[model samples]
Target: MAASRMYLSAKRAAALDAELMSSGGFSLDQLMELAGLSCAQAVYKSHPPESKRNVLIIAGPGNNGGDGLVAARHLKLFGYNPIVYYPKRPNKDLYNRLVTQLSNLKVSFTDDIDMAITETDQILDAIFGFSFQPPIRDPFVHVIGLLELTKKPVTSVDIPSSWDVDSGPPKTGELGAGFVPDVLVSLTAPKPAAKFFKGTHFLGGRFVSKEIAEKWGFSLPNYPGVDQVVELPVDNEKL
Candidate 1:
């Protein structure tokens, strides 16, 4: 499939962002919109024809969480039941806007990850945007534990919460290098962290892929006024 592709690492993802920003004539908000809408469409297509799932989106306070909220709103429009789990306090006005949109749409909200896990058929991880770092803390650690227990299908936006995008390794005390998301979605670039780090201790497989491109009906790279944008290398194995 056309979507069977790969992207760059978190640093590369950041580089792409910088490239776009330096090019000018576009704002980061626009990119966020594309990521969110694209994610929503991908999740919609992944479900079965008769599937009426209770989708749970776990979001942090960063842009990653924002993307998850965007997907939740779209999922609601697509007739699926979507609930958003916000683990941390939102720090940005844009994040506030997302919360407001969710409220306006009447999408259910929760601060408790455990509650969300119990209720959801599909889990979307928007927590910890990218660059999985050291020291797993309170709620995030709790959420990861819940993810381990649930074993439900999970789709991570950008990168999995516990996996370092560049190394694809788990954080401290994390047995593996990263979270084992059934599907890891990359917005504009592939995360190199999903590759490079391979060991018996590591998950040692593709942590990135573009399978959503075909499923979500993204025929062309999405830019506001452009027919097509730049094309990078496809790292299917990494995804």
Candidate 2:
């Protein structure tokens, strides 16, 4: 069930971007930061404290990857070594701050996806984020294959790569056959994409809603619903 009337949809998420640019006076970077920090808090709360555990963040080429990169930095600060894996070289917008942070921390980098996969204790699926529709192609399929092969504890930064945010898992094709996370660390509000699309058997697990988040005690300074980080705003434009 949609938590609130304000929940966001794919179309609405995009429109909100436009709305903010035109009226909200908020920059894309600021919004991205909000997403990143929120995601970090979700991660901290969902997983048990494991200073000895290693986390690998799979980054794509978009803003989603940028969110993962920010989380990686914070995860490191929280006492875990987070290694970020970029399938392709990240974009310039991401490179600006990402590179500086990595350089200062001198975080290890690897273009060879195979090598990075073997180095982590846990996996963070920052690969395709919300943009992924399903049936991953070529290189991505191969990378996700490695992740499945590892069978490590996996946590998606937002939504699992290519797993549709709504309509459950992709059933027709092999693009997103068996890609589910042990936990989904959502940002801002509950992603309809995350909630609706996560019921398939291939997903390999159940969802942990913001309500569950509250049970686990994930709270932040600027979070909308402190005790429970409610679902994303609904796509009212459609109604």
Candidate 3:
């Protein structure tokens, strides 16, 4: 089947997520693992390991960050030197376990985002997901500013950091002030902001049920063969 072109608003996305967790026979951990693995696969597919093996993953304080940590583990196994810059980590046991897993893999963690950005070949923006709002908070505001200054290629996890899930970025004078990712791995379903993303976009999260998709009007792309991540066409005209 062809991929669905439907885009979800932030509220609808959250509702679908809740419904999936409650009745879709999948746990949060399972979805996160799949999403993270798909994201790693997307990065690996986009930038060959022979050329761009040094990846810097910027994690936030939510499940999105946990996904990045999981991606870090998989990236390490995939022969990529993934350095994590997690300024704020959540206190949940699930997140702690993810950190432990990364430590077990001996993945390097850095407090310096700028240094990591300077050294790495590619970046994974796992800082925020669909629930983020504007008026950017503390250290993240500073971090986003630094990212805006850099020219390195970035692959955002679910949604680009500081981007509104329902609408695109705030209509300030600077349209591209924040981190503009070269690739986007949309978990579960693509948010409305994705329509404006002019990059190689991929749909992750393979656990969503047919019922949920139909009910929520999710136009999902079909994953090819054994691949877990499928690239979607970007509307370059919108860029």
Best by lDDT: 3
lDDT computed for candidate 2: 0.59
For candidate 1, write residues 124-227 as lDDT tens digits: 87887765565767777778777766767787776667776666656566643435776656655445554432211111112112353333233333333321
List model 3 lDDT by residue over 1-239, tens digit each. 23337777888887777777787777889878988999999999999679999999999998888889889999999999999999888788899999999999899899977788889999998988888866778788778887777888889988888888887766665433565789999888788788778789988856776767888876556788888888887654443
Segments in model 3 whose C-alpha atoms lie over 4 Å from true places: 1-4, 174-178, 236-239
| Cα lDDT for residue 188, candidate 2 | 41
Every model's TM-score? 0.75, 0.73, 0.93
- 187 in model 1: Cα distance from truth in Å? 1.2
Worst 10 residues of 1 by lDDT: 199-208
What lDDT tens digits, residue by residue, belong to model 2 across residues 1-239? Answer: 23232334565545545655566576767666666655555556555447335778787777788877777776777767777777676548555777578658856666777877676777777777655665566678888777656767677765677666655455654555566666665554334555443321011102223453343333322334442233233223321
- Model 3 CA lDDT for position 10: 82
Least well predicted 10-residue stretch by lDDT in candidate 2: 199-208
lDDT of 2 at 69: 77
Give the winner by TM-score: 1 or 3.
Answer: 3
Best by TM-score: 3
Candidate 1 stretches with Cα past 4 Å from truth are 1-7, 171-178, 196-239
Poorly placed runs, candidate 2 (over 4 Å): 1-7, 48-52, 133-135, 197-239
Identify the superior model by TM-score, candidate 1 or candidate 2: 1
